[model samples]
Target chain A: MTFPMGLAGPISGLVCGVLFGYVLQRGGLGNGCRLTAQLRLQDWTVFNVMFTAILVSAGGLYVLELAGVMHAADIFIPTTFLWATLLGGVLIGVGMAIGGYCPGTSVVGAAAGRIDGIVFFAGLIIGVVAFAGIYTPITPLLGAAAGPQAQTLGDLLGLPAWAVLAILTGVAAGVWWFTRRSAASPAITCAD
Target chain B: MMKQRPIWNSHAAGAVLGLVLLLTFVLTGHGLGASGAPTAIAAAAANVVAPAATQANDYLGWMVEGGRNPLNSWITWEVIGVALGALAAAWWSGHLRVRLEGPPRANNSGRLALALAGGILSGFGARVSAGCTSGLGLSGSATLATAGFVFLIGFFGAGVLTGLLTRRMWK
Candidate 1:
């Protein structure tokens, strides 16, 4: 209810994190090959899982916001820094391809006793420290273009949030449909 | 020594994860995150070791000002939970194993080195962009934040390109 802090926060977070991690491992995302299969265009499982989650949560949040049950404004919607988003995304993407796991997956993999995951996590700590050490020089660029405005996909596209969500969901569904059909065809081996 | 069943159906798992994200927002008014917790921890540690230097640093200073134990963070707990849950699932599924993942051609040392480099880059990127894949890509996108969309585009776009470049790794 009220934001988690102190004992309650850590307990709740631990429970949630465990569930989240369990789901990730169960989804085969803990496996590097299954995740990188997306890059090979040989598997659509990653895309399917990602967009499906997006669609469900997007729709769910919209409904919650509309019902006034959840104050969407309370959530920390990050400000848009065009350059940071683009640069950060590219860096993370490259890392995922090379490392075979993103931050979350790396954690899950580590729990499953994957040596690579542990190493990656150690790197993550080092990276954070490195960023801190260089914060003065990079502060401007890192925080650049971060206006306090709460813009969304709808605002950027000049459409209603629900409408955009609907359109996006439809597109995602179409992709899923096509991927399913292709995967089912005898010729394709559908990697994991 | 035995074949493993395919992990839960992707669609089903995605739906569950989506609902979890939605619940997180509904209950706490925040999305799931993984990187910030560690950063905060690092900041707190820095503060203890070198209070003046930590205070002087722009990033660590912001974290220290937030007024709470660095470890007492929502993301921190969620991450801990993630590890527990993952272990449980692995145990149940009989897929739990201690091993390094890499192309059969790669050695353990090489794989470990790459993992470290990748982690560093990913962590820095998450901080710069303000969130990691889950926090920014999933949570942010669900919220329809503009930054989220930009991040999604940048991450996936670069992913495809990089994947192409490293085609041999997977093959």
Candidate 2:
């Protein structure tokens, strides 16, 4: 069910965003070194934190939907375009490795007084403008390689939400265990 | 000054983060985001400089149409909260400092320049993908959206590759 924002939308959003930012900062995401470490495979902090968060949210979301508190249909799920998303992800990864920050991190990092973060935010503005300028040319490419409309993993696989959640939970646990093991073995990991 | 506090346990902090995300969805009918703010800021800025032209642009026009204020967007308010909350966190943790962050091999100037370039690429890519790590990777993944997983694979796949190639700069 879509929550009626009315006049409270922005205020509620601000409150939620504040808590979100606080949690991220406390989670060690405000530092560029910690974030970039994920790229170097020297630290699994990002992977651990992110995976845990994903699982928690997924469990809560789908479970609630199952319990009839939330409706999956009302949630905003961006239309899938395989090729565009893949290419976009590649670009973002390259940028993340180079900048040590993504869009969200850059904003929080800047607030924490990181100059590089501020610069990245400025760069983001410039990039958005650039994309706007070239919007027409990029339109076709972005729209190409579209996927099935309004489908989720559970829907596509013909599995119930609970089953999908269980499977993903298992996968996440395995990945987490592997990462922890890799971290424990100093022989394969780079010096942080 | 109080000494800097050690960061929280990764899993504990992440659990809290997840709860926050869930609250966001429950309250707002959408997930947390970061890229939309910059897009709106850009649109608002363009409106000031080239009102008609900016409003006529294909991508950004919707943001400024009908004398609409892009700054009034939900993401804009949320981002403002993010900045404020981050500042408070930094102060509370005694980690508030103004400095450049990078490996020793990269100088301040080079790092800043790379950050700018990286931001450009990320910002551009987020638009193309219709979201960033938070928007697409986290929120979309929670929804079990296929695009989210694909984006994550491509993102991390290329990220690991780039990090290896740029190891000297970082390590």
Evaluated on the second chain alone, the candidates' TM-scores are: 0.90, 0.96
Task: Give each model a TM-score.
Answer: 0.90, 0.94
lDDT of 2 by residue, B1-171 (tens): 546887777789879888888887778667888999999999999999999989889999998899999999888999889998888888888878888776669888988998899999999988889898989888888778888888899899999899878887764
Which stretch of 10 consecutive residues in model 2 chain B shows the poorest summed lDDT? B1-10
Provide DockQ values for all models, in the order shown.
0.63, 0.69
Report the lDDT tens digits of candidate 1 across residue range A1-192.
433222336766776677678778887777776666676566677787778888898898777678765665677676688888878888888888888778888888888878998888877777788888887898779767774587888888899988999888898988887778643334323222
| lDDT of the candidates, in the order given | 0.78, 0.83
**CA-based DockQ, model 1:** 0.63
Place model 2 in a CAPRI quality band: medium
Name the TM-score of candidate 1: 0.90
Q: What's the CA error at residue A168 for candidate 2, in Å?
A: 1.6
Weakest lDDT window of 10 consecutive positions for candidate 1 chain B: B1-10
**Model 2: per-residue Cα lDDT at residue A72:** 78
Cα deviation of B157 in candidate 2 (Å)?
A: 1.1
Q: Give a tens-digit lDDT track for model 2, residues A1-192.
A: 443232336788689889978888878887777777778887777888888888898888877877787787777776679888898889889888988888999988888888999998899898899889998998999999898885688767899878888898888788778788553445332211
